[model samples]
Target: MPEQTPERTGQPVPEPTSNQVPRLVVTWLVVTVPLAYGLFQTIKSVVPLFTG
Candidate 1:
C-alpha cells in the first residue's frame, strides 16, 4: 500500500479538484441556502421586538 500522506496524519487536508468543485458547491448551496433563509427570517421576525 502507498504510504499515507500528511492528509492522513490528522492534519487539514488539501482542496478538492475540478471534478469535485461543482458537487461541493451544489451541496453547500443546498444545505446553506435554506439555513441562511431561515436565519434571515428569524432575524427579520425578531427585529420588531427590539425596535418596537
Candidate 2:
C-alpha cells in the first residue's frame, strides 16, 4: 500500500502559497469574463424596451 503522510494524520490541509495566486486569478478571470459578457448582453436586450 502507498504511504499516507500528515494528510492521513487527520490534520487540515494547508492553504496554498503565494505562488498559487496567479493560477487562481487566471482561473477566476477565465470564468468571470464570459459570465460578465453574457450578463451585459442580457441587460442590453432588456433595457431597450424600457427606454423606448
Candidate 3:
C-alpha cells in the first residue's frame, strides 16, 4: 500500500491534474458512446412496433 502524506490525511481530495484530462475524456466517451448507440438501436427497433 502507498504511504499517506500528513497534509493529505486530513484534507479533501485534490482536484484532478491537467494530465488527467485525456483519461477523463476517454473514460466518459468509452461509457457514453456505447450507451448512446444502445439507446439509438432501442428506439429504432421500438419505432416499428408502434408504427405497425
How do the candidates rank by lDDT, highest first? 2, 1, 3
Q: Show the lowest summed lDDT stretch of 10 residues, model 2.
A: 1-10
Q: For residues 1-52, what per-residue lDDT tens digits would candidate 1 score against the true structure?
A: 7678866777877765887989989999999999999999999999999999
Candidate 3 structure quality by residue, lDDT tens digits, 1-52? 7679656588776666997999999999999999999999999999988899
Q: What TM-scores do the predictions have? A: 0.63, 0.62, 0.60
Error of 1 at 19 (Å): 1.0
What candidate 1 gets wrong by more than 4 Å, as runs, is 1-16
Any idea how many clashes model 1 has? 0
Off by over 4 Å in 2: 1-16
Index of the highest-TM-score prediction: 1
User: Candidate 1 local accuracy as lDDT?
Assistant: 0.90
Error of 3 at 45 (Å): 0.7
For residue 22, give model 3's deviation from the true position in Å.
0.8
